[model samples]
Target: MKLAVIGAGAVGSSVVELASDHGHSVTAFADSSSAVIDSAGVDTAAVLDRKRTDGVVGGGAPEDALSAEYDVLVEATPTTLGDAEPGFGHIQAALERDRHAVLANKGPVAERYADVRALERESEGSVLFEATVGGAMPILSTIDDFDPSHITAVRGVLNGTANFILSRMATEGLDYEHVLAEAQDLGVAEADPTFDVDGTDAALKGVIIANVLSDDETEYTLDDAEVTGIQEISGSALELARADGRTVRLIAEVVEGSVRVGPRLVPDNAPLAVSGTRNIAQLETEHAGQLNISGRGAGGPETASAVLADIGRL
Candidate 1:
C-alpha cells in the first residue's frame, strides 16, 4: 500500500520505518512543522534522521503531505481535545480523496465520532482506529469479525502510564509522587503527566471503544463519559487493597450505554491486574464468552504495529 503519514513523532516515524521494511511505500509524511512528499516513496531513513536531529520532518507545512500520492493516510499525531484539529483535518483530506485512513489518534473518534462517520458515509474511503483503543491488542478487529454479536460490555486497563504508576505504588508501597517521578524518568509518563494521571487518556480510549461498539442510532462521545484519574491514589490506599488481596488499576469501561474511566479495585489474579504498562481488553460477548486480549499498550513500535496492521487490512 502507498502510505502518507502525518506526525513525525514516535508512532508516525515508526509507521514510516515499518512500512518501508515491510514493502509498503510511504509517499508522504509530516511532522508538526513540515512534511516530506514524494510520489515514488519518501526516504524513510533520511526523514527519520531529519526528524530526530533537526526537529523538522519535512520541508513543507504539515498539510502538504495530504496531496502526496498515497492509498492509506496514517494519522498518528497527538490527540487534542475540543476540535481535534490537524489530525481530524488530515483524516478528512484523505477520505475526501478516496484514501483509506488509519488513525492512532483517539481525539477524532472519541470527540467527533458522528462527524467522522458522516464523512465516511459521504466519501469513498473508510476509517479504521484499532490503535485508538488498544495499542496493539486487536480490539476493533475482533469486534468487527465477531459473527454472533451482542457485546454487553467492554472493559480494560487502557492507559499504560497510569497502570505503571499504580502498579509500582502498590508493589513497592511507594508514594504516588515517587512512582510518578520514576515513571517520568523512565519515559513511561510525559514530563507533563496531567493527561495520563488525570484520566483523560483512558477516558478518550473508553469513549472510542464505546463508539466502536455502539449502533448507528446510538451516538456516543467523550462528553457522555465520566472520568476519574489516578492522581489522588496514595500508597496507603494500595496497602489497604493489598491487605484484602485486591489491586487498584485504572480501569476503563463501556457498559449499559455508560462510559467511565476510573480507578477500580480488582482481585490480584484478575486479568485486568496485569502490571507495568501492559494492557488488557475484555469483551463480554454471548457466544465467545469473555474474550480477553492483552499486549503492550504504548510505545512507538507497538502502536506503529497496530497502524501498519490497519493499513494492511485496508
Candidate 2:
C-alpha cells in the first residue's frame, strides 16, 4: 500500500517508520518543519535523530507538501484542534481521491467527528482513529465489538501526564511542581503541558470516545461536559488521598447523559491505581463491568502500531 504520513512529529514519524518497516511504500511525509520527500525513501532513524537534535518540530501546512495520492493517509499531529484544520483538509483530500484515512490525531475527531464521519460515508472510504483515545489501549475496537446500548458509563485516567504527576505526588509525596518538572524531564509531559495538566486533552479524548460509542444518529457535543484540570490540586490533596487510602487521578467519565472530567480520589484497589506514566485506561461498561487496557500511552512506536493496525484493516 502506498502511504502518506501527515505531521512528521513524534507520532507521525513513528507511523511512517512502521509502515515502511512492514514493506508498505511511504510516499511522502507532510510536516511544517521540513519537506524532505525522498521518492527512493529515507532512513527513518536518521530523519528522527535529525528532527530531535535540530528541534525540527511542528510540520508546515499539510496543503503545501501533501500532493501525492496514496492508498492510506495517516494523520498524526499534536493535540491542537485549531492547527488541525490542515490535517483535516488532507484527510478530506485523500478521501475525495478515494483513499483510506487512519487518524492518530485527536483534535480532528474531537472537534469534527460527525462531519468527518459524513465525509467518509460520502466517499465510501474507511476512517479509523484507534490511537486518539487510549493510544495502544484499543478502546475503540473493544467498544466496536460490544453493543452500545449495553454501555452504561465510560471512565478512567485518560491523560497519562496528569496520571504520572498524580502518581508521583501520591506515592512520593512530591509537590505538583516537582512532579511536573520530573514529567517534563522524562518526556512524559510536553513543554507546554497545559492541555494534559488542564484536563482538556482527556476531555477531547472523552468526546471522541463518546461519539464513537453513541448511536450514529444521535448528535452530541462536549459543550455541556464539566472539565477540571489537575493543576488545581496541591500536595494537600495528596495528603487527603494518603489519609483516605486512595490516590488522586484525573478521571474523565460519561455517565447517565452527563459527562465530567476532573481529579478524583480512587481507592488503592481501583484499576487506575496501577496506571503509571502512559500505562492504562480502565473503561467501565454495563455488560463488561470494568475492563483494564494497559500499554504505552504516548510514543512513536505505540502510535505507529495503531496506524499499522489500521493499514492491516484496510
Candidate 3:
C-alpha cells in the first residue's frame, strides 16, 4: 500500500517503521509546519529524523500531502473537538480523490461520523479506523461481526493513563497526583494529561463505538457522551474501596442510546481489573453472549501495528 501520512508524532513515526516492516511505502507525510509529498517514495527515516532534530517533518506544507497521490491516507493527527478539522479536511480531501483512508484520528470519526460516511458513500475509496479505539486490539472489527440489533451493550477499560493512575492508587496506596507524575515521567501519560485524565479520550472512543454499531443513525458526537474522568480519584478513596476488595477503573460503556465514561468499581481480580497500561474491551450480544479482548492499548509502535493491519485489509 502507498500511504500519505499526517501528524508525524509518535503514532506517525511508528507508522513509518511498521510500514516498511509490512512492505508498504509512505509516499507523503506532514507535520505541524511542513510536509513532504513524493510519488516514488518519501524517505521515512529522514522524515522521522527531521521531526526529532528540527521539530518539523519536511520542507513543504500540509497542502502538498493532501494533493499527493497515494493508495491510502493515514490520518493520525491529534484529537480535537467541534468540527474536528484539519484531520476532517484531510480525510475529506483523500476521499475526494478516491483514495482509501486508514485513520488513527478519533476526532473525525467521533465528532462527524455522518459527514464521514457520506463522503465514503459516493467516493471510490472506503474508510477504516480500527486503530482509533483499541490500538492493536481489533475492538472495532470484532464488534462488527454481529448484527447491531443483537449487540446490546459494549464496555471497556478504554483509557490506559487513567487506568494506570487508578490502579496505582488502589494497589500502592499512592495519591492521584503522585502516580500521575510517575506516569508522565515514564511516558505512559502525556505532558498535558487533561484529555486522558478528564475522560475526553475515553468518551471519544465511546462515541466512535456507538457510531460504528448504529451505522451513524445515532449521530453521536463528543457532546452526546456523558463523561467523568479519574482526575479527582484520591488514594484515600481507593483505600476505602480496597477494604472491600474493589478497585476503581475508568470504564467506557455504550448500551442502548447511552454512551458513558467514568470511574467504576469492580472486583480486583476481575478481567476488567487489568493493571498498568493494559486495556480490555467487552461486547454483549444476545446470541454470542459476551466476548472480551485484552491487550496493550497505548504506545506508538503498538498503535502503528493496528494502522498497518487496517491498510492491509483495505
Question: Who is ahead in TM-score, 1 or 2?
Answer: 1
lDDT of 2 by residue, 1-314 (tens): 87777787778887866776787877667667554454565456666676778755324444544666567888876666743576688778878877889998887777777778888988967899888877777777787777766667788777888888988888888899999999999988889999899888888877887787674765445565689999978898788877988878888887765668998888977777755776566666776677778777767788778778778878
Model 2: what TM-score? 0.90
lDDT score at residue 264, model 1, on the 0-100 scale: 96
Each candidate: what lDDT? 0.88, 0.76, 0.89
lDDT over C-alpha atoms for residue 239 of model 3:
87
Give the per-residue Cα lDDT of candidate 2 at 5.
79
The residue-level lDDT of candidate 1 at 230 comes to 92
Residues 113-178 of candidate 3 have per-residue lDDT tens digits of 999999999899999999999788988888776767678899999888988888878888888889
- Candidate 3 regions with alpha-carbon error over 4 angstroms: none
Kindly give the stretch of ten consecutive residues in candidate 1 with the minimal lDDT sum: 143-152
What would the per-residue lDDT of candidate 1 be over residues 103-143, giving only the tens digit for each residue?
Answer: 99988898888888989988899899988877988988888
What's the best-to-worst order under lDDT?
Answer: 3, 1, 2
The 10 consecutive residues of candidate 3 with the worst lDDT sum are 141-150
